[model samples]
Every structure is written in structure tokens, then in C-alpha cells.
Target: MSSIPSPTLSAPSPRVNEGMSQGTPACPSSCDHFDLDYTRQEDVRTVVETMMTAHQTYHNRMHAYFKKFPSKEAALLKPHPDTTKEQWKELCDLFTSEAFMKQSEQNKKNRSKLTVNHAAGSRSFQCTRACMKNQESSNINPVELYKKNYTNKDGIWTSEGAREIYRQCDLEGKTYTEIEVYSEILGKKSGYVRGLGRAVKPPPSSTLTTQSSDLQHQLAKARDEIEAMRVAREKDLQEFAKKQAEMEATLRDHREEQWVEQERIRLEQEERMKMEQEHMRVEHDERMQKEQEHMRKEQERLPVEISKKLEKKMSSVMEKKMNDMSKRLFSQFGGSKK
Candidate 1:
């Protein structure tokens, strides 16, 4: 087999044929010396552009991915384009309502979180009447999806799951008015929003966002100081209560001592009176016996006839003799002879 002939290496003609400048290099031009990072710079620009595009894409759901609805009725009636379009839009709205309702419920749930089981977890949900009305997110049909997935008795949402729900939905770093705070606290079982602020911090296009953030931080610190003061006051109140209890105990002890002293004095007086009464009684008995002896002696000296004549019978006279007995001798001596 014969090898093919090699092509001839011929140089181009050196003569200038065109009307352009003669000194310029043909292939290797002035751009060759310019300091450039062509590939790396292009790669960086491409990466930044791609990230920004992705962020924008996620910002709003794409119409190409999610079909558009001309109107509310159209969204409801013609959700599936395969269906007929002859009927009145409002009346036709009843056709694919289930799909609308399912999507609506799913989107709301996607925005909000819920809990299951007997944990009785708090889920903060749309507590504001205005915000909830603004959302316009509910089932087209009267289907109980929230009730099914989560536990619900009436139309009202439970505080148990509303906490985390409110947390995700709450705006960052903004403080609510007292009324809004009360509604959020009392109405829903507080979850995430409870710990979070009410409104967005550093909102878009704010010129004074930095100042506002500083103010918010300062306000929070002030609130913490006030809370600390309240706690100190509470501690002081507790200490006062302890002191009051101690004082009451001291007063009780003093009162008990007073009662004991009074009782001792009373018992001493009673014993003295009892002794005097007993001595008086003994003296009275002795005096009565002496009188009886005197009477008996007189009767013995008179004789039986005279004694019988004095009071009818001798023994009866002796039995009932003395009258108007002496005064109490107990008072004469305070347990000592007068």
C-alpha cells in the first residue's frame, strides 16, 4: 500500500491587500496583552446571577408551574381546562371547587404547623380578625380538614396548636399594642409567637432601620429592668410577710405570758380566800360548841323540873337553844389571830 503525499507548508503573502492599517498583527492582536481573567470572572458573574434568579423564583410561585386563574370564579370553575366552558362562570364555579378547597387548605397548612397526640401543644394561629380576613385562605367547601388532621370541636382553633402556628407567621422584632398582645395571649394558646416579637424588624427600604433596631433593643432592656424591679418588690413583700408572722408570734407569746401571770395571781387570791373561809368556819364551830356547853351547864345546874319548864321538854330545850349566831370571824384575821 502507498502512503498519501504530505501537504505543502506554504506561508501567506506578506503584501498588504486591504485598506486597513498595515502595522497591526494579524492573529495575535492588542487584546492579548490586556490583563484579564475571562473564565473566572464570567464564572463568578454566572454564579451570582443564578443565585439571585433562584431567590426570585422562590419568592413567588411561578405562573408557568402553577396555572393562572382569570378570576375567582374562573379559578374555581375552570381549574381543569379539560372541562367544558359553556356554562355561566359563577354557576360553573361549583365544578372543581374541591380542588380549590384542597389547595387552599394545603397552602394554609404549609404556612402553619400543627401538633398531634395528647401532648396538648400550643399552636399560635391567626389571632387578629383583620389579618385573618386579609388572608382569605379557607376551604371553598364546608369540609372539616383542620378538624380531621388536627383536633377541633367547634369553628374556633385550639390554643394547643396555635402557638407554633403563630410563631412562623409572626413578624420579627416589632412590638404589638396592648390590645393585640392581650388577644394573642388570651385568645390563642400561645406557642412560637409568644416568644417572638409582633412585627418585622428592619423592614424593606427603611432608612432608619438601624436606629429603630437600637431603640427596640433599648426598650427590651428597659422592660427587663422593670421586671427585675417587680421581682425585687415581690421579694420585699415576702420578707414583710415573714416579719409580720414573726411579730404575730411574739405578740402571741406576750399575750400567753400575760394570761399565765393573771391566772397565777387569781389562783393565789382564791387559795387565800379559801383558807380564810375554812378558818372562819372552824372558829364558828368552836364558838357554837362553847355556847352549847354553857347552856348545857346551866341546864345541868337547874335540875330536870326547871329544864322541862323552860322549853316544854328537857332534851328538846337542849336541841333548839341558841339563836342569832355570831358574825363571820374569817375576815377578822387574814389566816392569823386578831
Candidate 2:
């Protein structure tokens, strides 16, 4: 039997001259240089580009092969597209809208941190306003109340649980703003009412009962004192208001008197101005009349002076004409005698 021979591969064409330019000598026919990779590189972009080129070549070849053959069974064997275009578009739109809403809400919350609850764990730890106010009125520190009521086995306080315990407790005197600061400081120092953790055992039931009774008595006493103070404050306010009314009346009367005096002074000033104006007018008229009379006299004197000047001119002209005529007649008689 005859053995089939493998095909021989040719080297790059001499016309290409790429190897010659690089000064690389051509190899012998016996040498197997084809198995070796002479231009391998570790560059990531180069590797990726190589892979993309191979994938594209393979895809084009497969596409052409499939188009030529047109096999229904092979087409069925391939996986279908993950989703339709319309479905994909709808999902992207939904995600965009939801993500935008979430971002907007976060930005809004960041902009307006309205309450103390904006602090971490503060919502579940800080006492309610009403509870704080009540405890503050009773001269009980908020921190102490937090410890007595909310502290669990682990020595942590929860704001939600404190409300029920606060209801059973009694109240007393007026509360001030400073009380809250004091309570917060005490709570911090005690290290009991930490935000968002379990607390240890609270006060015993018997102690709570005793405290409630004492608080009740104190509350009644405080109420009576507050009532008396309110009555006294009301009386003082009424007296002050009455005095203010009287002072306002005096001020109004004083203002009216000032206005009347000002009006009188203004009227006198106008009268003085009017008289001065009238005197000035009379003076001006007299001066104008004198000036007119002087002008009339000057006009009367000017005509006579003008007539005298004209008579002088006429006499000089007549005399010169008579002299000329006499000279002419004498010259004529003399010529005739000669």
C-alpha cells in the first residue's frame, strides 16, 4: 500500500522582503520553524485585539457556512436571544426611572436633615418631645428616665419602649430649655442609653411604685405654686398695660400741643413774608415811575438840540454859494474889457 505524504509549506515571498529588512536569514528546508511562535507578546490590548480578530473571523466563517447550508436542525440547536428588543428597552427604561427616583430622594434627604433623627440610630434612641417635656417638668433628668425605663439586660436604651414607662410616671413644675442639655450630658456620662442597642435590667417594680407616689405629691404641690405665680403674673401684666395706656395718652396730648404751636408759627411766618413782598413791590413801582419821568425829559431836550444843529449847517452852505457867484461875475467883466 502507498503512504500519503504531508503537504510542504512555503516560506514568505521574496517580494514581501519583511524578513530581509530585519536581517534574518532564511532557514533550511529540514528545519521546523513553523511550530515556534517568534512574535508572542504579553501586552493585554494586543492579546485582546488578537482574540477579537479570531472571534470575528470565526463568526463570519460560521455565518457564511450557515447561510450556504441553511440547516434548520443546526439553527434549532443554537440558543435563542435572551430577550426581545421591546422587552429589553422597557426594562432599561424602568431601571432608569427607578434609579433616578432613588437618587432624587437621597439628594432631598441629604439637603434637608430636619430632625435630630437624621443622626444614626437617633430615631430609635432619642426620647420623644412630649416624654422629654414631661420628664423635664418633673425635675427628672431625661437620661435618668431612659436608664430607669428602657435599659435592658445588655445596658442599652431604646426610645420606642420608653414611652409606656413614661406614662406611669408623675409630673411636676415648669420645664426649662437647659434641662434637656443636662439630661443628655447625664445620659452620656452614665453610658447607658446608647443609640440602637439593648439595655440591662431597669428599676424594680417596687421602686417604681414608690417613685410614682412621691412624684404625685410633688406634682400637686408644684401645681398649687404655679397657679399662685400665674395669678400674680396676670395682675402685674394688667397693671403694666394700664400704665402703658396712660403714658400713650400723655404722649398723644403732647404731640397735639406741639402741632398747634407749629401751625401758629407757620401762619406768622407767612404773614411776615406777605408784608415784605408788598413793601418790595411798592419800592419797585416808585423806582420805575422816576425812571420813566427822567426818560420823557431827556426826549424833550433832544429835539431842540437837533434843530440848532440843522440851522448851523444850512447857514454855512448859503454863504459858500454866494462867494462863488461873485467871483464868476468879476472874471466875466474883466475878460470883456480886455
Candidate 3:
């Protein structure tokens, strides 16, 4: 048997990966290269986030906040209590209750009913209008074949024309008895509710009340505002009282600090005085010893008569030292001898 010719390769190497050709097509390798994979992964995460329990983070972190409903039955029928702080992590089953599901279902049902009654009704009406629009001919509706002879002038139909107009669109489909009954029902124009042209009558008090009631309402509103202002002022006064107490406390603290500062200064002055007194006492003892030695030196160097006179002066000097010696020095501190 003749062998079929082998297909020629496009290139020495394959253009596409053999692995890609062998397996099911994956999100492209370029997806990973261009970070599209990570982005798609995040998109998937976002979808999971919406589908999973709201407490997923808390579950993952082991920091769950527990919420409870008034009753299991009530929970099923209504929304659970507002989200709150939970001290401990709990089993996911605790939050999954039949009542919760029932309540969620009930809520969904109520919403569905509202949607059916209002939204669906509106949608149905819209669809019907669309169908009517599509079906409607561009031409104006022609007068009924029997009433073709009737004519309207200045775009206004006369009473005869009006009666004939309703006959074709309204009375045409009804039975004789129904038409006879409906014929008695007169059409009323504007400025009338029951075809009697009687709309509203003001009561004797209504007009009077209307005129004065506005002023009365204004006065009442003003009074209410005044009362509200009074209450607000009272509340402000209470708040101000707290602020005033705080201010007084701060002032008291400041005064205590001032007193402490003054006491510290007074003690410093006392300490300075004590140190000066101690210095003066030491100087006095040294001066007395020097004077006694000087008297002895004078007796050896001078005549006996001069030495005796010096001894009398020495007693006077001793008395002067007692009177003149004091704490502190300098010309500012006046002494009896100086």
C-alpha cells in the first residue's frame, strides 16, 4: 500500500506549547505574565466575599462578634438585631438558624409581593403600551362607518358628535340592557364631581378658621420654638455648669501652685541666712584668737606702760566685735563700727 506524504512542519520547533494543546484551555499564560490572573483571582475573591458570611474576616481572625435575635421564630420572619461586638469566636452553626432562614424567606416574599404588585404591574402596563404602540396605525382613527356623515368643526365635536363618538368605542360591544343602563350615566365635565356642578362648600367655621388659623398656627409654632429654646438653654446651662466647675478646679490648682512657689522661696531665704550666720561665727572665733596673740606681741615689742594701755583697748575691741559681728558683708550691710 502507498504511504500518504507526511505533513511538513511549519518550523524546526513548535509554535504552541504541547502542554497547552494536550490539556483543556486555561486562562492564558499571558494572564499570569500581565497580572491578569491575580486580578481575576481578586475578582473571584470579591464574589466569594459577597456570597460568604459577612463575618468571614472575624472567622478567619478568630475574633467573632456574636449577634442574637429576640426569638428564633421572630428572627426568621424579620431582620436580625443590628450587628454587635462578640467577645468570643463561635461556631458558624450558631448563626445559622431555621428561624433566620425563615425570616429571610418571609422578607423576600414580602418584597416579592411588592415587586409583583407595583413593579410587575408597572412593567406589564409598559409592555402592553409598547404592544399597543407597535400595533397602532399611523393614520388617525376614522369615524365609525355608520357615523361617517358626522362632522366636527374647529376641532370641537358637537353634542351629537360626542354622543355618536362614545357609541362606537364604548356602547358597541355591550348588550342592549347594559347599554340602556349605561346610557343613564351622564358624563360630567370639569368643575363638577357628581354631574351636579357641586364640588365644595366652605363651612361657616372653615373660612373664619382659615383666615385666623394661620396666625394661630404661627403663634403656636412660635410658642413651641420658645419652649424648645428654653429647654435648650437649660441644657446648655447644665453643660456650662460642668465647664465652670472645671475652670474653678483649674484655678484652684493654679493658686495652690503659687502658694507652694512662695513657700519654696521663703525656705531658700531662710537657708541663706543660716549659712551666713554659720560663716560669721567661724570668722569671729578666728578674729578673737588673732587679737589675743597681737596683745601678747605688743607687750614684748613696746614699753610696759604701752602694753597696759593696749590691754584696756582690747576689752573695748572685744565688746565692739560682739556688737558689729553679723551675717553677710559689703557696704550695703551697715554695722556700728563701719
**lDDT of each structure?**
0.45, 0.49, 0.44
**Off by more than 4 A, model 2:** 1-227, 318-338
Q: Candidate 3 has what TM-score? A: 0.28
| Candidate 2 lDDT by residue in tens digits, 22-61 | 6544421212222222233213333454467567665444
Clashes of 2: 8
Best by lDDT: 2
Judge candidate 1 at residue 267 and give its lDDT: 100
Task: Tell me the tens digit of each residue's lDDT in model 3 across 1-338.
Answer: 12223211111112223433465232122111111122333334434543463465444333122234454344444432343223221233445557655875797778765311211221222122222222343221222211221324243333454555547555545443222222223222222211111111112246777876787788778888988999999999999999999999999999999999999999999999999999999899889889989988887768876777888799889877766653334334656567
Candidate 1 off by > 4 Å? 1-205, 304-338
Each prediction's RMSD over C-alphas, in Å, is: 33.9, 36.3, 31.1
Task: Assess every candidate by TM-score.
Answer: 0.31, 0.29, 0.28
lDDT of model 1 at position 37: 32
Q: After superposition, how far is residue 101 of candidate 2 from its true place, in Å?
A: 47
The global Cα lDDT (0 to 1) of model 3 is: 0.44
